[model samples]
Target: MRAFVSMLSGILFGFGLALSGMMDPSRVRGFLDIFGDWDPTMAFVMGGAVIVMAIAWRMQKAMNKPVVCDQFSLPGTKLIDARLIGGAALFGIGWGLAGLCPGPAVASLANNLSGAAIFVAAMIAGMVIFRLTERPAQ
Candidate 1:
């Protein structure tokens, strides 16, 4: 049941990304290109997501356990560190250059097989590298 719900949610999210034109690298690039023909569509999408997530967070706070899960598995860390900042910088650079983050890139694989495949492959590689190189939390 939990797996089914997770799959359904992922499908819905991918569909939303496709409908919002987020699956298109050009649209994402336009949104990031502040000095060029800037696009505000992604901003609206992100704002909507933030609002929805805020409501969801409030609802989650009131619940003891998730409908499909035993308990909520939220992030434990709250402190910002050098690794976080460095990872964020690298992510921003990659997003600016390729105009596709993980979610959108995976969603885009249905339409753009080659590029999305490459991006996903590299992303996996980066994750592996990070896992191997990162020091255990003190």
Candidate 2:
């Protein structure tokens, strides 16, 4: 049941991304090009997502526990440390350059873009490198 729900949720999220024009790297790049022909469509997409998330969060809070899980799987850490900032900066830079974040990069695989394939391969390589280099948190 949990796996089914997880897969369904992923499909829904991907569908939303596609519907919002987020699956296209060119669309995202246009949004980032503020000095050029800047596009504000992504902003509207983000705003709509934020609104939906806010409402969902409130409703989830009203519940004692999740329907699928016995307990919530929320992250415990709240502090914004240097590590977090550095990682986020790296992510933003990569997004700006590639015009595709992890979600969209994976979603765009169906489009058979060669760049997307390279990006996904590099992303997987980076993940493996990070796992091998970093020690597990105590």
Candidate 3:
């Protein structure tokens, strides 16, 4: 049941990404092109996501447990540390260069995008390296 829900959620999320043109690298790049031909589509998409998540947060606080899980597996810490900052910076840099973040990049794989395979491979390698070198949380 949990697996089915997970698969359904993934399918819905992928469909949304594709429908929103997020699977297109050029569209994402345009959104990041602040100094040039900027695209506002992503802004709307992001804004909608923020709105939905804001509501979700409110509802989550009211709920005792999640529908599909025993408990909500949200982030444990609110700490702002060097590792967090560095990871965010790295993610931003990759997003700017590749025009696709993790979610969209994974969805782009199904489309057989030209550079997506390489990007995903490199992303996976980076994750593996990070896991290998990660320090124990303090």
Score every model by TM-score: 0.94, 0.92, 0.93
Residue pairs with clashing backbones, model 3: none
For each candidate, how many residue pairs have backbone atoms clashing (under 3 Å)? Answer: 0, 0, 0
CA lDDT of every candidate: 0.93, 0.90, 0.91
14-121, model 2: which lDDT tens digit per residue? 898889998888899999999999999999999998999999989888998988899887767668988789999989888888889999899889885798899899
Give the candidates in order of lDDT, highest first. Answer: 1, 3, 2
Write the residue-wise lDDT of candidate 1 on 1-138 in tens digits: 989999999999999999988889899999999899999999999999999999999999999999988889998867888878988999999998898999999988899999999999999999999889978878
Candidate 2 residue 129 C-alpha distance from true site, Å: 1.2
Quick one: ranking by TM-score, best first?
1, 3, 2
lDDT tens readout by residue for model 3, 1-138? 999999999999999999998888899999999999999999999998999999999999999999989988887767898888999999998998989899999999988666888899999999999899988977
- Over 4 Å off in model 3, which ranges? none
Among these predicted structures, which one has the highest lDDT? 1
Compute the lDDT of residue 3 as modeled in candidate 3: 100
